[model samples]
Target: MIGMLVTFTPRSGTFDRSTLEKIAGELRGPFDGMPGLRFKTFMVDEDGARARNFYVWEDEEKGRSFFTEELVEKVTGIYGAPPVIEYLDVVGFVDNSAG
Candidate 1:
């Protein structure tokens, strides 16, 4: 499976916290269920300023799909326009994230 890591910097320091949560929440079912999609995630920068973050996509085609999907436009409405996204292959993952 192909994996992807997307990171972005928001336009400014004006991003909303709940908005980010809602965005992460909304993507759960839609993108997760798509063909070649294994998992995904994202977070705003820790400084609570710039948004340098990442998420994983399971396959190359699925990675490509995000841009082609109509949902890209929807995200801008909530998260602001044109955030930079990066794609990558997972060499490893350590999900020690506390539940």
Candidate 2:
């Protein structure tokens, strides 16, 4: 599996608990059954100044294929800032519930 971490700083006065929940609600349906997507988790700082997305993909190519310029722009537009995207080789993972 491949892991991806995307972090971004939210624009001034643009992020809050309500907005974060709204974003999560909007994403639930479309991302539920994406091809090559194993899992995804969204996180934000308690102060709502920053956010991050953690994704696990079936493979590196699949992971890379999902990040497009349009998507980047969309995220940037939503948060009012660009994101820093990082790809990593998933050396190991542990899921207790799956056991």
Candidate 3:
């Protein structure tokens, strides 16, 4: 598996908790059952004025392919800032929900 972290640091007083929550709620349905996606989470640091998205994918290629230039531009427009995307090897994983 591979992990992708996308962080957004918009300017002060731009993006807020309510905006992040609304985005998350709207995107959750579309993201569910997405191809090659194992899991995804939207996180916000209200105090720090940042938002992040963590995604686990079946492979690095699938994860890398999902973050295209068009997607970045779209998200930048929505979030009011460009994101810093990072890919990482997933060394370990646990799913207690299966139990």
Model 2 misplaced stretches (Cα beyond 4 Å): none
lDDT, residue 38, candidate 3: 95
User: How many clashes (backbone N, Cα, C below 3 Å) per candidate?
Assistant: 1, 0, 0
For residues 1-99, could you state the per-residue lDDT of candidate 3 as single tens digits? 999999999866646788789999988997888898999999988584789999999977889999889999999998888999999999999978787
Clashing pairs in 2: none
- Candidates sorted on TM-score, descending: 3, 2, 1
Candidate 1 segments whose C-alpha is farther than 4 A from its true place: 93-99
What TM-score number comes out for model 3? 0.92
Which candidate ranks first by lDDT, i.e. highest? 3
Question: Best TM-score goes to which candidate?
Answer: 3
lDDT of 2: 0.85
CA RMSD of each candidate after superposition? 3.3, 1.7, 1.4
Cα-based lDDT for every prediction: 0.61, 0.85, 0.89
Residue pairs that clash (backbone atoms under 3 angstroms), model 1: 2-58
